[model samples]
Target: MNSCATSFVFLRRSGYAGLLWVLLLSASANTLASPVSGTLSAVGSNTMAGLILRWGEALSQRHPDINLQFQASGSANAPSALITGTTRLGPMSRQMTDTERRAFTQRYGYPPLELKVARDALVVIVHRHNPLAELTRQQVDALFSTTRECGANAAINRWQELPATQDWPFGAIALHGRNSASGTYGLFQQRALCGGEFRPTLSQHPGASAVVAAVGESPGSIGYAGYHHLTPNVKAVSLINAEGQAIALSENSVQSGDYPLSRYLYLYVNAPPEQPLPTAEKALLDLIFSPEGQQIARSAGFVPLSETVRQQQAHW
Candidate 1:
């Protein structure tokens, strides 16, 4: 993730002159994380890496004396790092669990502060060539888990097994998903699996790209990842919630609560009683909520935090 800034260089339009244009160039992680002098560490959430690096670069220009660093391990690492005093800033794609919050309160005498950073749709993807139209919450439960709690689930394993109208001969469905460390993995279990455990056969990967890539390359494979990780070779399948309305995964759908798997990305910090957030942290969070920071987030494929959420972040 760190080297992504220099990995692929691309053209950004500098000026438009009808027929001829002055092209500007940019990096995937460019202008987002400028180098600075001090030491700082941000550990957690591979999903938030690109967006944070972009903000870090921009923050550096405004405060050269403060150096803010970040790590993109996985969502599960965030609360743990904060509890251990290993990182001041922990980014997460899901809400901290009760177990995680208990540990933080025991360690810090207060629950770690969480600020909603962005909105994301947790999407299930399969090879673009797959003819499947949509998946019901129950069907997804049956496909991914052993427990068939959702009314429609029947421990289905093949394309023809679904109650969908069209059935062509296809191999057994292949399941891929994030490993235990991913918040997405947990959220899916709760929502899609209806509190059921993931089947032992599910192939668990470390990050979103890996999950999406594996599914894209395998014709029969299906997997889930943040909306940002969807690739051209893979198509996001619409998911029907328990309410019976099928909704596509999109920023608007996620924002409007129509997307069943929509989730809030977060940042956890310790703002000791009225003492201002440490200077470096303050600068970073300000950039995060600023129009510029939110724009970068949008460009990275996340929905901006709602005005109500931003207003709450302001008060927090």
Candidate 2:
């Protein structure tokens, strides 16, 4: 072949290869870019507020295209916001009720997807100065329930009524707890009170922080809140289980089901199986399950799922 002809062939082949490489690089860049661009709104579950806020902040750093907004309403508000198409995500401290599911299905032609993201134990907290360190589930019931037990245990109105309450000069035992709007209150009622009603005298706070604060400030008082809310001003009191074991609240005990009040924390998504979840919503989910997300949960004083459960949940 002529030298000019050979040079032309080499240039043509090199040009085609370079074009192919450029096309591949472009595709890779597109893949790395944000898939969705829009605001993502989540509402409900004050128990999940701190963790979600942290996740949202991290998400902003990773995907500046997404604008994430959240509201820390009580868990009871999740189903309604989800039904009204007002929120892309809803965090709940409890599983959705059948009524809630039906309402959602009626509105959207499918039930909301429920994801278990974390676990919490409903702990009874008291002022650190209060010497009461433990109580049986039955005792908790008597203290909180209007239908008091046998005569001797009919009421736990006084701090002194509790056995061996040390050196506490007490008046009435002030009671505090989550308000009716809170999922924590519902769970506490079911798990601790055995579905009994809260005594009318029980002071109801709007959120866990308020309950913790109230209990922390009251000398002869106690309140129930998520285990994660434990702070220096207040102390978690151990609960006695059926076998007379004083189960301490911890990630290990809660995950092992040894803690009587341990329960799952959930995120209810408004996605249908036939349709893909919104990209921004899915990204937030990734952040929640990411290693950094789990660390954020730890910082919020909640328990991340155990390794086995976490792996299984990731596949979901």
**TM-score (all chains, Cα) for each model:** 0.81, 0.82
Best by TM-score: 2
Q: By TM-score, how accurate is candidate 2?
A: 0.82
Error of 1 at 182 (Å): 3.2
The alpha-carbon deviation from the true structure for residue 221 of candidate 2, after best TM-score superposition, in angstroms, is 1.5
Per-residue lDDT for 189 in model 1?
87
**Per-model C-alpha lDDT, please?**
0.79, 0.82
Off by over 4 Å in 1: 1-38, 163-165
lDDT of 2 by residue, 1-316 (tens): 2764565567568877566556555655664676655798999887788888888888887776678888988788989999998886999888889999999999988778888888888898889988887888778888888864422257687877777584589878889998785677788888788788888988988667888998888788888988877789998889888899999877899987799889888999998877877778888888888778877888888888877877777666
Worst-scoring 10-residue span by lDDT in model 2: 147-156
